[model samples]
Target: MPLPEDAPELSPALDPWEGLEPSGGQGSGGGRPSKPGPGLHLVATPIGNARDITLRALDVLAAADLIVCEDTRVTSRLMQIHGLHRPLMPYHDHNAAKVRPEILARLAQGAVIALVSDAGTPLVSDPGYRLVVDAVAAGIKVTTLPGASSVLAALTLAALPTDRFLFAGFLPPKSAARRETLGELAPVRATLVFLESAQRLADMLADAAAVLGPRPAAVARELTKLFEEVRRETLDSLAAHYAAAGPPKGEVVVVIGPPTEAAGASEAEIDAALQAELAHAGPSAAAAKVAAAFNLPRRQVYARAMALKAAAP
Candidate 1:
């Protein structure tokens, strides 16, 4: 993605920290008084590449009274790259409860505080929900500086249906719980987006295949960085590939196409599958297997399975 010809050229001469008074605050020596007024600014950081961040985000970060982030080390590296030296504070799942009140107090005092995650947008499977809620309740101004997100990036590369979609975040680590979660999402009419761990990628895909049938999906890794990869295929095929190749390195995002009429098993096909499974397994077991294989509702499959058994001569 290149900048437009009409777009302003970004150079060292174009300072990102132009309009702001010198800071007399905590964390760092170069604390700058924010010009954006008192508010909670939710900034979106780049997911992978260092340069993917927006110009507006940089400005807000530079002008913020204090920068609250998931990890100071991670945020520090980003700040260093763009020649920014703002006061950085740690605020994540473990420390949000303790630090949120202090942040709110600052916001109340007309301090422009910028909240950001390690990457991407805040509150999208990231922290900062409670802070936003508290800020709003306290009548403090809240705003967003949206930029790069792995969810949208993967969807773009997936070539899947995008008109309607859901970002379900990460699934359960265990197989049983994960399958149950996938079963719940099996009937969704829109495409699905998920962030997954590298080690659990294979297992997650396996459960997804068992519960979602053979929907078309894509596995995207290391997005926007060198060695970025997107493997698009059926859910079952992806499961098999990961099972064989093991998990790849870096962050992962999985995009699955929505359910389709063509993907649904026919009544005859269901009956045949049920009959075959019932020959060796009990009704409950047979239904579970068939329903999972077809991505159909278990109760629906079980009812038909019982009918077939009763009608058997």
Candidate 2:
């Protein structure tokens, strides 16, 4: 299909997903439905596989008067594949501050606007958070068409505990800053998910290994597409493997397992360490130092140290 005037340019080779026609039920293809009020729709697009998008997302995209996305070309190509078109407006980090007011203005005029990222869900390691925040504050209706997400995909691919998981988004670029962030999350009981570039994958994994210990981990890349691969191994092994092999191409999702039970120090072990520190320094200093080292509360360590002191002869 040729690109629409409002759609972005796409590769000459149309994706296989493009072959699938947009469903009739949703506002896809046919025409916009008559919704009484205008609202902002947060649409989740496919991460790698074009067919991964939801029917509702296509309907909203087809129905919405304006569709705001990170990259017009990227979204335009996808829309072209599905044979859907709409006014594509740029709403990315670079120009978010400037374009946000315009989007709000359209919403005020009862023009339904759908926000999408280049891939995956918007505001998920992507832009659109500010727009959602502002829209909600203005009492503008907001709806989410949940669909493909790299974080959820990585979590499923990693086969880690999902009852509780934290999406830390992308780590800092600087080694020191990245390490600092990892250190803060080291003791979190929930599995951790981070979006990273293939180039920085090795370094990020190494820092995670150092700060979070040798936990079980997985690296998922090219999610939901041909040649999609997910590798599960120990943190040290992954760090070493990626470091030697260099970063792989395509998008990457790094999922690290939570601290193992064995790694969680026993009370006796902690008390011993606390006793040694308390003997060398005052209780407060000892508590502060050990707490920082273990990512624990100083108050908790201070209480433990006091208990140890009382137990002493």
Error of 2 at 301 (Å): 28
lDDT of each: 0.86, 0.82
For all candidates, the clash counts are 1, 2
TM-score of 1: 0.74
How well is each residue in 1-313 modelled by candidate 1, as lDDT tens digits? 4466799867878777799644443443566534777799999999999989876788788889999999999999999998999999999889888988899998899998999999899988877898899999999999998998999999988766666789999999999999999999999888899999999999999899888877778999999999999987778899999999998999999999777542646455777899999999999999899879888666556655776786589
RMSD of each: 14.5, 16.3
The number of the candidate with the highest lDDT is: 1
> In model 2, which runs have C-alpha deviations exceeding 4 angstroms?
1-37, 263-313
Give the CA lDDT, 0 to 100, for residue 195 in model 1: 98
lDDT for model 2: 0.82
Write the residue-wise lDDT of candidate 2 on 1-313 in tens digits.
Answer: 2355799776778785866754556446646444424799988999998989886776688778989999999999999999997889988889999989999988887888989999988898766998999999998999888998999998877755666789998999989999999999988878899999999999999898888777668899999989999987767899999999998989999988766443477445666688889888987888788777777655556655664565579
For every model shown, what is its TM-score relative to the native structure? 0.74, 0.74
The per-residue C-alpha lDDT of model 2 at residue 253 equals 92
